[model samples]
Target: MRLFSLLLCGALLTGCASPPPDDPGGTWINQAAIDAARESGRLREALLAYGPNLEWQIHPERQQASYSNGFELVEGRLQAVGAGQWQVTFYGDYEEQLRLQGDQLTQVASGYWPEQRFARAPTRGDEQAPLGSSFEQALYRDYLGGDWLIEEGQGQGGLVRFIDNGQVQGLPGAERFALCLAGDCAAMSGEHDSLWLQAGDQGSPWLFVHEGNRLRIFEAHNRAQFDEMPEYQPGPQRWLLKRR
Candidate 1:
């Protein structure tokens, strides 16, 4: 009887010591990190740690696609060349690359990336540049900059000076890129995330995400252009910053 009782206790203890429930909340991939990987075109390797620990041997030649968390994962075919630098061929024609330092990204877009906006450049000033001068640019330059609002309008506006601490100065908002003001505001977080004024629809926004040397402007959803007005669509747009 004594032996049976000891055995039962041991069994109960063993059962209790078994692995706890799985992490039902799922993996820890933030939208920013995922966007970073996708922009770098390294979506496959970025996803390696998301699922069960499986020994995945990435074959460059024969592997048509990779799988992660039920998403028929494909190789972003992103190449990392040391020191957090990466290059990607987005949607085939669009070429982009990024250099990441700590949490800052300097994004570059060329070839197909700027095809649509190329025509507008010759007629515009710094504001119309893909990297319109903004407080964010000031931060990148001095690492300590702020701005005041000069004007505001739909599709066009002017900021007296774009600054880093837009919140502290109580500056009225201005549209930076084609994204709406609200879209640009939501992208503001810490010193890491990029900032941009959304193009149209003050409510919908464009999120500035810094991944590697690249800073991408993205939308949270999709809509059609109304009477030549830019529409907000889901997915992100990566713009290369021409170093000044």
Candidate 2:
């Protein structure tokens, strides 16, 4: 029966088809911010700060999520109410309603929150550096976390502030941390006086050493590079932003 065989084959193929990658099970990156950085001509700074190389993991099965820029982890009750739809309640009466459209997950703007987009990560966290210690984490939160005005002639003049709430640029899904949080400060050779910090995972990390009335900024890729050339020739002649 040719018709019977055709029907059976169709059923078999349907049963064996792989699931879509849209499920909220893997990693996501702040692509919207990345695009903004590229447009603003701060692609390198954006990549280091926002970490285009980094990833944010979402475990739908465990109802857990981890941000790559080393904020705190979020655990909540994730419920699938419909296809491509999920609601995560992290705290009392606080909800993070999500919508998955192909590669982008949008936290639909609700109440005072605005819409934020996160693109699926190209790779996982296996290839990246780790976030620093609990003690170091506290220091970073207190020391480096502040409202900063990206001074003119520095990099690109703008408001680069790290808020108490887990949002960068008034959007969700980003946090700031010490770029050298893994206890590698001493490795800065003699440039040890400076504090290196990273925000989002997009912008490049900047070194801040308290110099007189302002926190002088030195731009670099990461801590490992800084360790190799502490007396980095370019030296403290750029980025005069203050941590207000």
Writing each residue's lDDT as its tens digit, candidate 1 over 132-182 gives 222122222232133323222221233333333232222234433321111
For model 2, give the RMSD to the true fold: 16.8
Per-prediction CA RMSD (Å): 20.4, 16.8
**Quick one: best TM-score, which candidate?**
2
Candidate 1, poorest ten consecutive residues by summed lDDT: 115-124
| TM match of model 2 to true structure | 0.43
**What C-alpha lDDT, on a 0 to 100 scale, does residue 173 get in candidate 2?**
24
Q: Residue-wise lDDT of candidate 2 within 1-244, one digit each (tens)?
A: 0000111334355433333766776656666544544344333344344442233456786876544433344456778878898877766757767788877777667773556677664333222323212223222334445666656443446555543222334112224433342123424423433333334455333454543324455554343454454332224445565556
lDDT score for candidate 2 against the true structure: 0.47
Alpha-carbon lDDT, every model: 0.30, 0.47
lDDT of 2 at 105: 78
